[model samples]
Target: MNHLKLVFIILCSISLVTSCASERSDDDGIEPLNTSESYEELNISYGNDDEQVFDLYLPANRTADTKTIILVHGGGWTSGDKTDMTDFKNFIKDQMPSYAVVNINYRLADENNSPYPMQINDITSVINYLKNNEAHYTISNNLGLVGVSAGAHLSLLWSYGFDTENQVRMVCSIVGPTNFTDPAYLNNTNAVLQELLDTFGIDTATDFLEEVSPYHKATATSPPTILFYGGEDPLIPITQGTTMRDKLESLNVTHQFTLYPNEGHGWTGLNLLDTTLELKIFIETYL
Candidate 1:
């Protein structure tokens, strides 16, 4: 499977799914708004760093009660920009117009700077900035996180462990790594996977690994989560999703897990459609 082609197909499917899903209304007490006055602010800096900026999209007729969805992209925590999530941001803006969208860019990790607490801190800063300026943005503190790969790992880690105020109502992970300490990772011989793990310092103490692993950080009170994975993914093994699912179940946390058996690190076509619909429903139910 050509990776680029697969990504294109995924994006196309998302656009189609968003178009189809937008026509349906739910009796879940939330009504879709019809307006043409949405707001968008790009390169809003939450910190001094160059990468500490995010793009905000405020829906038309939004209020302080309006919820938020934050998008985090994936590039092994060392690369990737906010633009990588443009498709998702647009999908949310069009399909879930009542909700606000934030696509963020965090400092990429390098040999001199590790990804752990730093990238995690960036997420915290983004949330703090949002809450501090809630009245200005006219959005609620309630949040839904949607991340892919490394971004997904960060979303799970923060929502499960670092969310002190319980602001995150729901989170969705697409091909995200959940457990750094999972044997699938620790024992895998894949150089690319190992290189990515090295950014977190593979030689570190076991406790530290557990500290960063969402599988270990999740508790009964953790927010509802939905996860998607591919059975044949070269970077993230099947255990990454299944283990987290099992952990969520053991803790009695509300969660959903979907696995595409023949796909790789990412997927497209009907599976992507299913993922988008499932994610949309989960957000409606929990966020």
Candidate 2:
């Protein structure tokens, strides 16, 4: 009887400790999570960089034929992290429970590290990781990319500029800076123009800017894409999305564009819903 009592006491102690630790989040006066979605933290590095890490969000119920998507966060290729989009990723996972979404942190630019290669290299590493781990997730190699702001530019340029093997299946650019040569942007009398060029300048006489611009690199064979932008986005002029859509149309590439006359940078309510639905449809069609 003594031995049995000791064992019972030990088990009870463990249970209490577990319960206390589990309640830590709520100890700060928070409620329980309404929905449960499982996520895994992963470390990916090209070299010996300590900050090279990413997070992958997987639906709790694994899909038999899982689809994959890679998310690139926007900070003009100069700043940002994978965790910035957790809320959005959660929203997506709730809506489509069969897709595995990846949020990535790419190396940012400095004097030595130009945008020419680092951004695309980070994306390529992510694709390679997915391709290798497809079996683990039970997902197909069919992939898509979506980005906001600077992330939008990266998504478009990488999808259109990169070859199909490293390419995304479908791309959605949320107010992306597409055509650098647009009359609105090319002729904007604002400091934003100079700030953009100042970041990518090899010299005044170089064509490297064009090389990185999606509009300059677009081809008829580019993958299907959906683009969204506000009519009044100050950072990105109207011509950016419209001109790119024009090019895609002329080339017969599959594409769609949505413009909200009263929104900016981002959207809310119906416009946001419309954009999200369009993206859901686009990915469903491809992935």
Candidate 3:
């Protein structure tokens, strides 16, 4: 499978989903913040690294009580940018106008810079920056994460393992890899998949794999989560979603899972619509 094609499909599908949802009216019963004006701050740096910047969208009438949604894009951890999630930012702005949105870019993984602690630390820094500036941004410390593919994995990992303050109220993972140690991954022969996993390290230890896996890090107190997966996805196997769903259920965590059996990597049309609708409901309920 062509990795570029996969990335293209993921981006296009997300755009299509959000675009389709734009035609629908918002009736989620979420009270809109009473701010008189909305604001957009672009390239707000949270750190010295150029990729450490994020774009923040503040809805009109937002206050210290306003909720926030942070979006993380996906390119198998090595590539992708905050701009890739533009449609998602727009979707949240239009649908959940009361909530603030942050679309962020983190240093991508490469031969020297591994994603493990580096990417996770970036997420931690982003959250810390948000919390530190909550008063200035006029938003609450409460956060909801919406991430796709690699971003989804990072979102889950950070929320489950790194968020000690319980700041994340909800998280949504779209076709993210949850378990690196799963048999489906360990026994897989996909070259692209192997290349992506190799970014973690060569001769990686089992303990390290489990340490990085969201499935292994999640606990009973993990925040409410909504998961979406494509059963036919070439990179992520169906078990990645099902096993995580089972684990969440066993932990008695608040969660929902949806599997599109016929889809692969990404989807469009009715499935995409369904995803957006379900996501909207999840955000309304949990965020």
Candidate 4:
């Protein structure tokens, strides 16, 4: 494995193994700490409830008027934990201290099953959970979502189509696949890559494929959006971002689309930091 992917895998694994640790305040759920003026309780629930649950983090200094940020972790929709994304959540919290951060975990897919409505359904439940206890968290009905890759796909779909609370004001997607029908996927040239992608082969089924495609479900009413993609994202072609950007413009939803022409599935140093900064600033414009 390449250096970065190896590191990402290690970090993700460490977070997952430690996910069940007793909850902590401002510490990765795996660690412990005394509550302070800036950090408070880290309320968590098994998003699966009857099964393995996930965790949630809310800032103590926030108020009901404060806009919250819901973050989704990406591992090809099959292997990620909310606690794994604690790094991203804490980064945002440190930058925008007042914004409450809600990270989530959803079901994964393997040989026997493809993760489908399972994760989306869990997303719906999380939204409901947040609203039911919104008063206690001091987060407002106004919310924003940020996701990377597979998580990006979920954030966009949930905000655009099934936001039951109608609370998602903005969403940011980083290197998320917009069109599953791309030639690279539909007419895949790499045999090994194709096999890995089509293992579940749901895209061959019409309604089923659309069932998970964010672009297929986008409408004029979708919330304002910001997108960032590296020009060389192998799983997601440049056409994906362009087509979506064109569609959003047609729908006239406030949106911004950015591309790092030299980058790929993920970004690095300066571009990464800049993209994150942009999200913070752009979210403020709407939230």
Candidate 5:
């Protein structure tokens, strides 16, 4: 009878081990998350325009102190959708499951419409919407921003210049243009680039360029910032990141800047992993 009882206990232990292994396997790379721990709302409109919509992802444990990160996708302000931010949103959700995410779409620039006020307004509108519904969502008033390229530019501009309520706690820029009036941009002979400048009426006057440029707008009180740049990016000059880093330094603002030496407009492999870790650290530290 004692021997039989010992065998039964061993068998139960083995079953438990197997069940644990199966659960870990089911997780694959994503952390095992309770299905009830989070929820997602897609295509919530903030304004009348089709592009002025955002997707919200709320963690199950969200409360008034739960941090929220807003993601903006890059398409040179002429194209791109909130869908472009999915991988980024998923990465954040996977790494920081406690945080909420708001992925947004803004009006695209065209010959007839400039991106400046329209795109900037769209971002604030989304923020206002979130604030209006924060109680319903059970999220904190604190906000962080992570943006790529043109979207990054807008994020920086808004965080530095337009966040009147001081709600933005941190800002991250990936391959974003910082200085629209940089000589590299003004002197570049690329026709397509020139066309892009024209689309924003940047070539029309330096005043508009200064108005839209994040570097020109950054202040000492600007929120903590993390900037990523590619040394060889054709669309964005290295000065854009470097200059901003220098400006932030002069102002004594809390910031970090990473320039991948061999990278271009985007990264892959270990570079991507490095960026992910850097961003994780930045958000963890500030948000």
Candidate 6:
């Protein structure tokens, strides 16, 4: 792997493994079933690139009222896959058995592909495919989104700005950067962070940062939102969540914000359960 990909992988591994260490136990030994009877499709292509595909699952008991939620994985916008969201997909199936799940892979940022318009466009294509084939899948066009970190950022940005069809009913952002223009990001001196920023094709001279930032794109018409943050997260500042929360409030947009005081970039154990419950409630109410 290249240096950037290696660095990104290590970062993701550490956060995902260690963040939830406190919550797992020897007794939590049962594993979720790998394949469900409700499998609708796998490796369904939405675009030209190999990464522009998704795995889809339907609830066995799905009906007219059943909804779908798209799950996007985080890897600092570069090194993650749809498989990374397997646990969250299982959580949704276990908790909300009536919902359909779409776990997708978008082209990661690299030397050739910048994240902003490329990633944003990929999500739009995925949504369009689902909407077009709703009958074949036996699903409603209304969709919700749950995403982590960079995925969360893309979810919010697309739902807020590019969802021209208004199919997205709600969104849940897990430790995503709501505002890239925040001083917390702009003033960062970390070399790795600087390198990552460069991949986005952003600079101080243009409005590129604001253009990609969900915080700047949110409007009164934005869909209902649920945001989760870790007070101690080293990557996403508490301000990213709080600032967006404040904006959503001022606009009178329906929303919820939760912060786990002791957690970092991610969490484990009961915190995961609580986050799941919150997600269920959000979907029940708005989606």
List per-prediction Cα lDDT, in the order shown. 0.78, 0.66, 0.80, 0.68, 0.77, 0.79
Candidate 4 residue lDDT tens string, 1-287: 11111212222322111135332222223332222344444436635343334455665656668777888877776677666577678788788877777777777655455556666777777777667666545567788888887778789888887886678999998877676555544554444334444445343555645656677878888899999987866557798798889889999989999999988777668987888789888988887
lDDT of 2 at 132: 59
| Model 3 stretches with alpha carbons more than 4 Å out | 1-35, 190-203
lDDT of 6 by residue, 1-287 (tens): 12322223334443342211121222355343232346556778887788888888898756655689999888877778988898988888888888999999999876666666888999988888876666555678899999998889899999999988888999999988888677776665555545454544434442766787899999999999999999999878899999999999998989999999899989989998899899899998998
C-alpha RMSD values across all candidates: 9.0, 17.0, 8.0, 7.0, 18.0, 9.3
Over 230-273, each residue of candidate 3 has an lDDT whose tens digit, in order, gives: 97887788988999999999999999999999998778889987
TM-score of each: 0.84, 0.77, 0.86, 0.81, 0.84, 0.85
Clashes of 3: 3
Q: Between candidates 1 and 3, name the one with more favorable lDDT.
A: 3
For each of the candidates, give the backbone clash count: 0, 0, 3, 4, 0, 1
Alpha-carbon lDDT of model 1: 0.78
**lDDT digits (tens) for residues 1-287 of candidate 5:** 12111111221111100000111121235432343467777778777777777888899866678889999887767777777778788899999989999999898776677676889999998888777666666777799999987778889999998999999999999988787678876665544434334333333367767887899999999999999988987667789999999999999999999999878877878888889899999999999
Between candidates 2 and 5, the TM-score winner = 5
lDDT of 1 by residue, 115-220 (tens): 7789999999999888867766668999999998888889999999999999999999998877767766555454443433443433346786688788889999
Clashing pairs in 6: 23-269
The regions of model 5 sitting more than 4 angstroms off are 1-37, 191-203
lDDT of 5: 0.77
Compared to the true structure, candidate 5 yields what TM-score? 0.84
Top candidate (lDDT): 3
